[model samples]
Target chain A: MDKVIIAQNLSLAYSKDETIINKANFSIDSGSFVFVTGASGSGKSTLLKSLYGALKPIEGSLVVGGVELCGISSKKLNFLRRHLGIVFQDYKLVKEWTIEKNIMLPLIINGYEKSITQSQVDSLLKHVKLQHQAGKYPLELSGGEQQRVAMARALAHNPILILADEPTGNLDDYSSQLIWNLLEGAHEQLKTTVIVVTHHIPETIKIDYKHYHIEFGDIHEVV
Target chain B: MKSFKNHISLVIALVSILFSLQVFTIVERSIDAYKENLAQNYSLVVVSQKTLQKKELLDKITTLASIEQLSPDNVIKKLNTGISKKNKELLKVTLPKFYKLQLKIYPTPLQLQRLQKELLRYPYIVKVETFSNTHDTTYKLLLLFKNVIFILSLSIVLVTILLIFKELRIWQFKHNERMSIMGLFGAPAWLRSAVLFRLAIVDALIAFGISFVIFSYFSSSAWVSEQFANIGISVIVFDKVYDSLIMLGVSMTVSVLLASFIVLGHKEEV
Candidate 1:
């Protein structure tokens, strides 16, 4: 299997005085589903941020899709981001835009034609079961609906990898089950590499997935 | 409707500034035309013992456009009302030579004084009367009016520019989150800022159109035309095409520059 992300002795930190992840080592193979579980403030989010070039590594090597995260230029970072999808815990959907436009954002940024972008957005709307709410703004939708819209947006451009941070953390049981099923479907059907950050991993997940736990700034694969 | 209300204050501020500027330009031109009309009718009376050539007078007073020698027939005719022919002839011979000295333009009080002193240097010249009292008062009043308009226009422009900038900054803040999300999605800087530029362009056009209509109506108004006629000078209140083009340019430039400033500031913070 090809390695999509490789981190050797990576040190993540917000500032030089405070380190979040010290000497962390991890590698994620292509087309694999993985879960990162940790307690509050255990540096799970920081490690995910470093993978997308949001947080810089204070020390050691970290690479995503052959691009180094540490000391990356803004132009190079943007280029790297084009090949990845990120789902924030708060949904991060543009409040002023309609749900359909929000789903089309990544496709537009990737320079897809208007016809293609429209069709893609329409398909994603159906996939997320929000076809009726396509014309509504993000603020008009429920938390579950908004999160599903964000997920559809993340998958709009068919990116090589998707990094979801606590996607089901704030959802109800019904929305959580729907999101988990969507992630499983994307991983199994489309063969997309997915790394989800959460405090709990559901035991009912039937697909094969690797689990990593973080504690006291140390990352270890549990199974 | 909310967006329109949000942008209305900025549009009004821009329009006020632009209208003041247009009024200032029109008033300045009108005053210039009035000054030229005054110059055409104004001249000084000079008495000289010796016959003076126009060229020699011009050499001595560079400000003098021409000198016209006045005939003594008017004085002779007045004295002849009750006198004999010989006495009238003698009165004519004794009368001093008078010449009307025309000026190229209306002179400032200081320039008039300098001209008087320069004329006094000639041994043959005796009296020079410029009617300084009336000319000085008129000139001073015109200058005071022009300065007041200029200062008022400047104040309006300065205040409105600050207001426009503040309004634009608010708009920028309102749109910053959306722009940042676009940036994270790999949108280019220009793409992220497209909405701001569009807003600027649209507002500029609206302000330009409003100002153009108002000025056009003023230019054709009876009161405006009557005011210029009263001063004995015909002035164009505004040049429709040329002046509007200039106003359009100013409106667009100010709006675009302010929008760019806000966008650049947002980028730096992000």
Candidate 2:
């Protein structure tokens, strides 16, 4: 399998003299479900940010979806981000837009036809079980429902890689299970690579997956 | 209510700026037309020691429109009636030539001085009366009026632009979150700030419409027509088609440019 993400001596920092994720080396295979576990402030979120091009590497090489992210121009990074779906912990939905419009964001940015985008949004609404709430705004939805909307949005574009930064971190047990099922289902059905960063991994997941734990600013795979 | 407030603020600023511009244009046109009227009635009296040829005078002074010889019979009649008819004839023959010089356009004070110097360069053309006292007073007053209007209009435009820019910046702040979210989704800069552009364009159109109606009404008013009649000059206060196009262009350009500034500033902050 081809590697979707490759990091050799990747170091990420918000500023100089304050390195967050130290010279970490890792490679995530295509169509694999991987969990990055770490304690609070262990640079788990920073590592995920580097993968999605939100944070650039201060020292070494970090590539995602076959594009080198270190020193990448904003224009090129934006183009690369179009093919990758990202879900944030806070559910960064445009509050003024309706749920349908929020889910349609990725498709609209990709320049998909309006008719096709509408149908895809409709289908995703049904899949996410928010079909009845398509016209409501993000604030009108509950936390779980909003996260489900975020999940639906992340999976809407059929991206090659999906990066979730604590997607289910603030959700209830049932909501967390629902999010996990979506990630697993995407990997199985669409053959998409999934990288999720969280403090704990739910043992209920039955699929074969790889685990990488972050400790002492280094990422180590756990057998 | 908040959106209405925003629209009203921008419209008010734009209307004030457009009003100042219209007033400036009207005042300028009126002054120019008045000057033309004055120039038509004004003439220079030139006394020459030798007979002055019309073609020669025109060639010497390019601004000379027409030169008509002043009949010396009237001045001669006012002289002593006891003089013999032959003496009168001799006096007329020996008298210097008198010519009225009318210019094609009104000359500025400096141009008038230059014309005087040019005319005096011919020794035979000794006495040239330009009526400098009256001409200076009228021309100076007209110039001062034009300069005052220009400075006032420029100041109003500058202040209104700053107000519009401030309003747009506030609007951008309100929409920053939405724009930032769109940015995260790989939306281009234009798409991210589409809302700002839309608001600016809509407000600009509204302002243009309001300004057009106001100017059109004022231009055709009876009072405005009477004022122009009193001044004895016909001035075009507004040209519906031409002025409308200019106003539209100016309002759109100002609003769009200010909105673009806000968008770019926000982008830099991000």
Candidate 3:
């Protein structure tokens, strides 16, 4: 399988004096589901941010979807991000927009036709079991519903890679299981590579998957 | 509702500024016309011992438009109340010749005084009366009025610009979250700022429409006509198509420019 992401001697930081991820090396294969486990403030989120070009690699090379992100131009970074889907812990839905419109955001940004976007959004709403809440605003939805909406939004454009940061960190057991099932379904059925950062790794996941644990600014693949 | 309120405040500010601009233009034009009328009606009276030719006065004072010889019949009649016919005729022959010297335009106080001195240089000319006191007072009053309007218009322009900028900044803050999310989704700068542009354009159009109605009514009102008549000058308060187009252009340019400023500022911060 082709590698979708490759990082060699990568170091991440917000400023010059404070490094988050130091000398880390990793590669993620296409169509693979991977879990990054770490303690609080162990730079799991920083690693994910680096993958999306939000933070630059401080020391070495990092590439995602055939684009080098170390010193990417804004044009190049935006182009690379077009093929990526990202989900945040807070859901990050636009409060003034309806649930359906929120899900249609990525498709609209990608310049999809209105008819196609509407059909895809309808299908995603059904998949997320929020078809009845399509017209409601994000503020009107519950936490679990909002997260589901965010998931639908992330998958709206059918991106090749999905980066989820603590997607189930604040959800109840039922919502967490639902989000896990959705992520697993996308990886298996759509052949999409997914990288999730979380403190908990459910033991009942029955799939061919990889695990990388971060400890004290170091990342290692766990057998 | 809050958005509507914000838009209304901006529209009101823009309309007041645009209206003040139109009023300034009209008042300036009216003052110019009034001064032209005054210049046409004014003339300097010169008394000479010998009858003077119009060409001679014109040559002496380059500013002179034309000079008319005043008949001595009125002066002789006023003095003939008790005198005999022969004495009245004798008094007319002894009186000096009077000429009215008209000018091309209204003269300043200094120009009037200079003309008086130039006319007095001739050995035949005896006295020159320019009526300088009344003319000088009227000229000063017109200048003071123009300065007051100019300062008022300038103040309105500065205040309106600050108000528009503040309102646009508030709108930017309100939409910042949505715009940032859109930006994270690989949306371009134009796409992220589409909503702000729409808001600015709509509010500008609304202000233009309101101004159009108010000015149209004022332009045709009887009170405005009466005021112009009192001053003996007909002024145009507004032009339907030409003025509207100008106001529309100004309103849109200001709105769009301010909106673009906010968007660029937000982009820089990001």
Among these predictions, the greatest lDDT belongs to 2
Q: Which docking category, incorrect, acceptable, medium or high, applies to candidate 2?
A: acceptable
Residue pairs clashing, model 2: none
Q: Each prediction's TM-score against the native?
A: 0.91, 0.89, 0.88
- Sorted by TM-score, highest first, which candidate order results? 1, 2, 3
Which ranges of candidate 2 are over 4 A from the true structure?
A: A139-145, A171-178, A202-208, B1-11, B80-86, B171-176, B193-203, B266-270
Which sections of candidate 3 miss by over 4 Å? Answer: B46-67, B78-128, B267-270
Docking category of candidate 1: medium
Question: Model 1 chain A — which ten-residue stretch has the worst lDDT?
Answer: A47-56
Supply the DockQ value of model 3. Answer: 0.51
As for lDDT, the candidate ahead, 1 or 2, is 2
TM-score of chain A of 3: 0.98
Off by over 4 Å in 1: B55-66, B74-94, B118-123, B267-270
lDDT of each: 0.87, 0.89, 0.88
- lDDT of candidate 2 vs native? 0.89
lDDT of 2 by residue, A1-223 (tens): 8999999998888989888888989999999999999899999988988887777788999989899998888788878878888899999888878999999999999999999999999998988889999999999999999999999999888999999999988899888898999999999999999999998898899788999999878998999
What tens-digit string does per-residue lDDT give for candidate 2 at B118-208? 8888889989999999999999999999999999999999999888778877777767878777777778888888888998899999999
